[model samples]
Target: MGGAMAVRVAAAGHTLTVFNRTRAAAEAVATRCPVDVTVAGTAREAAAAADVVVVSLADDAAARATYGGSDGLVAGLAAGAVVADTSTVAPETTRALEADVRSAGGLLADTPVSGSVSSVEGGTVLVMAGGSAEAVERAAPALESFAQRIIHLGPLGSGATMKLAVNAMVFGLNQTLAEALVLAEKSGVARELAYEVIANSAVAAPFVHYKRAAFEHPESAPVAFALDLVAKDLDLATALATQVGAPVPQVELNRRIVGDAIAAGRGAEDLSALAEHLRG
Candidate 1:
């Protein structure tokens, strides 16, 4: 998604300074970008070069790592820079980082995104941004290069909270779809046929449309979103529910199913692999 976002931003005619955990991965993204892309050696270097810095990482730990330390992004941020973090992390994490960035003379926004890699490449992803109005506005140009829809959702950490909520629904839908598909197959309906009807049915979602290949042909479909990542997201979501004293029975069940799949060594598979797990 970071690579795709880089390409999309470059396609929009913005020069970028790209940095990844791996230097080679950053170089690869630079090669794919249409506009000039400087591959930065460190997160700090990348942050120093841009008015708006976009950080896309795996989780809260990665986000914290990339933004801390002597050579981290916070150390090299240009004063008054707007840093938009696109990682799906705990709201607490985002709010903590926001303070660090603030003290460094920069603003930070939790700008979690929604949509697949293809949607990112096509510049159709949705961005849910949370920050002060000034900060969100400053980050909009960078986010708009890749996101067709960008919503400013109040102060810091709002995007992270909303992302957790959205993902809870997503995981629930995935679980239900897997169960429904397995039930259909056991009742003699073809997997492909069942998926087709589901994709067109009243319950059809954007995810159902894009996940067709993975659900119908798991063996060949690429791992767009891995089951391990799904498990991680569920973990964050369920944790947030507990923190807020909310009863999320269905999300807990989804988390357990994902945990079981991971325990069975299917963690690296696509989320759609749940159907196969359920079939067993």
Candidate 2:
């Protein structure tokens, strides 16, 4: 996702320096754009030199590890540099990171993206951001290059909260789709016929519509968003619910189902592979 965003930004005439734990991955991303792409040896090196530094790591632990230490972005960034975090981290972590960036005389913006690889490649992702109006305005043009819809939710950590809420719905819907397909197949209905019927129904959605091929083949192409990542997002959603004292029973259930799937060694598969469990 970060690589795709960087590609879009660079294509839009913004220079970018990328840092990844794997140098090859960073180089691979940089090779796609005709920009002054500096492959940094560490996060700090990348952050120190960039005007607007974007961190797009896996989770909170990874985000913190990339910025919390002396060699992290926080220590190496110039004063007044804008730090845009694109990682899906906890709201508290976003708040803390924002404070830390401010303490260092830098600004932080929490901007989480929503889309699959295809959507990102097409520059149609939805971006929800939370930060100061000035910071958001500063980042808007660059963000606009990659997002079809960019909404400023509120201040500081609202983007993270909004992202969690959105993922909760996605997780639930994916699970519901899996169960529905499983039930239909078990009832001796042809998978293709079931999909045709559902695709014409009111319940048919973009999610189900897109996954129809996967439902038919079961073992289709490589997974774009792996089940482990889905599980991680669900875990984040569940944690967010608990932090805000909201009872998300449905989210909790979906978390367990994804968790069980991951534990069963299906973590690397597409989230739609949840149908395999339902087939049992």
Off by over 4 Å in 1: none
How far in Å is the alpha carbon of 222 misplaced in model 1? 1.3
In angstroms, the error of model 1 at 185 is: 1.5
For 1-280, candidate 2 gives per-residue lDDT tens digits of 8888888888888878888988899999999876767889888888888878877888988988888788789888889889878788889999988877888889888999887766777888888899998777777777887889889999989888898898888778889888888899889988888889888899886667667777678776558678888878888888877777999999889989998998899899988888887786
Clashes of 2: 0
Each model's total of backbone clashes:
0, 0
* Candidate with the greatest lDDT versus the true structure: 1
lDDT of each: 0.91, 0.84
Q: Indicate the worst ten consecutive residues by lDDT in candidate 2.
A: 215-224
- Alpha-carbon RMSD to native, per candidate: 1.0, 1.9
